[model samples]
Target: MTRLISALLLFALACASAAVARPNILIIVADDLGWADVGYHGSTIATPNIDRLCREGVELNRHYVSPVCTPTRIGLLTGRYWSRFGNTGPNNERCLPWETETLATALRSRGYDTCITGKWHLGSLPEWGPRQFGFTHSHGSLAGGVNPLNHFYKHGKYMKTWHRNDRLIEEEGHATDLIAREAIRYIRMERDGPFFVYVPFTAVHTPFLEEKRYLEAVKHIPDDRRFFAACLVHLDEKIGEIIKAVDDSGQRDNTLILFFSDNGGQNPSSDDSRRYPDTKPTSKFKGMNTPLRGWKVQTYEGGMRVPAFVNWPGTLKPGRSDALLSVTDWMPTLCALTGFKPTANLKWDGRNIWPMIRDPSKANRDRTLYCKGPGGRTRMVINDGWKLIEIKNGERFELYHLDDDPNEERDLFHSEPDEVDKMKRILARERKADDDARPDPKRKNPSPV
Candidate 1:
């Protein structure tokens, strides 16, 4: 009888240990946030909460994503490059197959409760939302960035994109506030297992609408950038709220929180607000990648390399690293960290970067990173420290050693014929894998960039 009691106690303790070992994962993604947008990155925008996390976490100074939102999200969730799905730009169609295994699904299989409360742009319809891809609970815009107050996407059948779980529901609040509210609610919920909370805020994205209170906070900024600054302030505050919720829940020590932007900032453009209901007349929407070349749509350092960091109270020490990491790496890294073993090969283009994140001293050199721009007009490959930008299948090429010219200002293609040949071969190899999943006969050289 005593032996039986001892065995039962040992089993209970083992179960408890397993639960504690698997930390709760919280990933917060900002839409269209730029490299120079965060307070730590020398932006004038007040991001106290984001800065605090950076100060308390490991900053990924060289982290990369796709040049656009949809591809970045696809890479993040699937642990593979968006080009694998033949996606180079944002699309309204379903991006994933029904049998796809996502970060949420992998974590859920390990007894973690997965929830996402913000932009689910991978698929616009309710049937194709986060739940279909393994999220147990999902809320916020199913489409891309929406009008801040009205919570509507661009004028179309998918305009009403807000939802909970698998159904679209009407809500009455600012989009940022609503998303944070749902995330905070989920964090505060009573549960038996660890949770995976993905909060992809739709702040600072488009239409440039912001609350007056946040606007007042950034009153010192110029008129052209005041609303954008206000959006940053609002986003920062909500991030603080969600972090506080985790702290209040006594899960701060047992939760790992990651924050990053989907892609780079956009230049002043009214293209996103076309045909939207009751929108103000076309005005400049401020976007800044400052000191980095290119905007949101190009595969330059400015477009793909946005702000990113990881925070866990006693786990990840505060520091900055220039390790070459991609957005797709999060799935494999987080799954490995939380003990979620994949049953089969997930065909991830990204490597597990936890080693580099845990210790900034460990550099990720010799890893190749590839990016294909919209319509396949431009392609970039970074191997070692050299970067090659090929336009329309070598019709025009720009090469730079990022170790020296991180801004990509110097064109070394004509100077180094040998390096250009080597990079072209590498780029060609990477391109061969593109469009294999969904073959596009028009994947050939797109229009000139």
Candidate 2:
């Protein structure tokens, strides 16, 4: 009877050990999605699945990113500001350096099957692709974004669509649909082990190519905003599909899903009037950054602020966090969640947001959030409730008290000179830290623009 009890105890321990294993991670990133584009954020777009994630998880209201895609991608992958690596250049290929450590590489070291699907705007260099960056399986465009219809690469060059494991495969559906399908397939195939699936959808970006079915569904919304809303809905459906796949695989309880946008939306003026005033308003291309000033490509809150949500069925309780977090926080946060120790020598500008996810009320991340605009021409820093903006070659400084003036209309540079100086000193110290860590002096530029 003692031997029988010993055997039963051993079986119970084994089961418990299996249950305590690290959970699977799914990071779904939407390209150019606005702060209010998702349903939970007060948009009319039918994003039920994404909304569900927000409802059942933690919605990060004060999440921010780079003004554009490439820099934000670099920060999200490396857990450091892209400027530290000289990746703040305007071009997409210049953002993701070849030697930098990525989340995939870090997770792969801990026995997680890392896979990336959809846009890889980091670099198109053969050696810098996702497969080379530690993702075992990668399938998507190598450029910043793509043309959904022609499957074109950067500069309108046609490249063969990719497939599982970097294989050149042809896809018949929209780019978003193809990405979603592959994500579902990967989840089903790797349900047994801990996996990291990075689904960075190239939806609602540029080259507005909407599926006819989605367009037809939103015909009643008028032509101008119809395609935009439909694209959002399509993305929402794809999100639903992936969520269902995770549930169907019986890993729902052991999976952690994060949803967020890479950056703000692109606002193309009608008839390119902003570029050529003679032309009429042809197409009204604008992102819904309603209450915030400016849009994409600017150093304003509307350009950097993005919607972020984290959902882990059994781990994180449903709630909303106003804790100021940035894309740079993801790497360290994920490492903490998965019990992986980050490299001792690797200095990071972002702190782990794991505590915020676990208990939103307990988070105390009040550090300064810095952002560099295109070509590093414009720079801004948000510390406490004040935002200090410095435009390239501009003599005057623009400061906004976010608590009182969230829209950034009231410039308090002169009114609050003391606060501005305090933030400037902090910003200077942070920039020096970044400059000191650089391996190459030529790559380090204090003035971004």
Candidate 3:
């Protein structure tokens, strides 16, 4: 009996040690947030909470993502380029194969409790929701940004996109508040093992409808940017709330918190207020990606390169890393960080960047990055600091050595024909694998590659 008791105690200790080794991953993604939107980035908008995280964590100065929401999300979850799935734009159809291995699936397989509590735009319908992609629990818009109060996607069948665990439901409070609340609740919940919480806030996206208090908080900003500022302030506070939940749960040091925007913020555009119900805004919407070349949906630095950071108290040191990275790296990096070894080839396009996060000096290595925009027209590839943007798939090509001119003002295509030719070869090689899962009009769902 004494021997059996000793064996049980040893088992308990082993379990505790394993739990300690597996850190809780909390990825907080802001929708349509610009590179200059956060306080640490020198934006006028007050993002005290985001600033605190950037200051305390490893600020990723050159992190890249797709130019749009759907592509970025797909790249993040799958650790592969969205174009590989034939997705270069915002998609409402089911993008992934039925058997795709996602970040959530990989983590969950390792006994991590996975949950996504915000926009899951990979598929708009309930049948093609986050749970289908391996999330154990899901809440918030199944589509893109919804009506703030009404919780509708747009004027269509998937408009009523609000749900919890893929079952459509309705709630009252603002989306930013609801998402943060759910994330915090998940963080504070009593669970057996480590938790992976993805809080993708639909804040500062579109149809800016912030509460009076939040609006009043940023009243000093111009009218064009006032609403966005208000929404950002609200988002910043909610992010702080979620972080505080982790601290309160005594899991701050045990949690790896990653914060980044889905894409670069857009310039002012006509407010498509008619798409949603009860929205009164008819003026232009505005977002700033100051000092960067382009806005959202373009292949330029401002569009793909976004604000990002990783905060893990005591584990990751606070500093800035200008290493060229992509949102696709999240899956491989996080999985590697949590000690997950894939049984098979997951076909990951992303490389494990944890070593870079651990020691910044080790980050500077030659790597190639690819980005394909909507409609298969615009494509870009970055190799050894040479950035190439193919407009209309080669009707015109713009080349910029980012190491020399990060703003992309000078076009070196004519002067550096060899570089352009090399980049074009890279683009062709990458594009060959695209459109593998594009939607078929005759069928309900496209076949997976």
Candidate 4:
């Protein structure tokens, strides 16, 4: 009788432990995808899987990121402004200092198996790789971007291509498919406990390539754009596959999926034309920022704002929000959700949005947000609806009232000098706080190959 009681008590404890395990996290980051690229945002592109995530989850309408890829990635990983850590440029080996605490590192400490399956543009150095940053397994290109067919850098100067656990390997399949297959494989094999999978798809970026079936499906839309659209479809299917894997593994209820783009889409022609001339000179796919001006490389709304959605079976409510959240907020928000404390010594620029996720109506992010770009030449600050932009050189300080002029058509720098002054003062204070929050001085930059 006593032995039976002991066995029953042990079973109850096991069940309770399984029920309380930290939620599995899947972060799907699309490369250079515009806000309008997804069906939820009104793009003609067929993104049913992504659209479903937005429909059944919360869509962050005013989500923002850095003006370019690498900077935005740095912000996403550290939950701090990229500029604060001197990671303000593209293709810079000095960015993302080794000692910085990454999302992968934080989650891994909490007993989660962390894996990254695509683009690690933060740094190309040996120490900067995913393994050094707490990811147990990583497979993908290390540079900002890669060619689809040959899996080579555009310039052909960088020899670093595909890598799997520190060993270079030749990859034959299309990049997007390769990433998706690896992500699913990880999910299948690592379902014992909570796991974090970072799938940063190289699709819909430059040198757009797709499988023959996908390419043939969209052949009617003109070659270049058709191929681009096909890539989107391929990405959608892969997203569905990943979601299905989680559901089939009985981990769906405890899995939280976050989908977002690294930055706004590039003008396909600008990059696509250089490689493929016969392909109908790539044109804008009309991603709906409705009133935002500019594209990928600018500090305007369209460039910085991208689609952000979160879906966790029983946690987040389904809806849309314009709460002005940035990608940097994910780290702290995820930490809060999983009951993990962020590093006490580190200062993060992002605020926890978990409360907002639970109840969107109660969401209010009032902190000032900052963005810095290449050479630290481009900078911008957002506080509520007002924004201040400071470009390099002697360019005039530009101010915009985003609430009223969403397209940023009219400059209010001279019209509302007092408001601009107030914003400037606020920005000054915020900048001081950020500058003082630097990482350890002894930390060295990762070496680039």
Q: Report the lDDT tens digits of candidate 3 across residue range 98-170.
A: 7778999999988999999999998888888898778889999999987778888778888889999999998
**Model 4 worst lDDT run, 10 consecutive residues:** 277-286
lDDT, candidate 1, 140-186, per-residue tens: 99998888788888888988898998698988999999999999999
Candidate 2 per-residue C-alpha lDDT over 46-75 given as tens digits, one digit per residue, 9 for 90 to 100: 788898888999888888998788788878
- Candidate 2, overall lDDT? 0.75
lDDT by candidate, in order shown? 0.86, 0.75, 0.86, 0.76
Colliding residue pairs in candidate 1: none
Q: Alpha-carbon error at 135 in model 3, in Å?
A: 1.2
C-alpha lDDT of residue 349 in model 3: 85
Instruction: State candidate 3's TM-score.
Output: 0.93
CA RMSD (A), model 3:
4.0
lDDT for position 217 in model 3: 94
Per-candidate TM vs. native? 0.92, 0.87, 0.93, 0.88
Q: Give RMSD (Å) of candidate 4 vs. truth.
A: 4.6
Mind sharing the TM-score for model 2? Answer: 0.87
- The per-candidate count of clashes, in order, stands at 0, 4, 0, 2
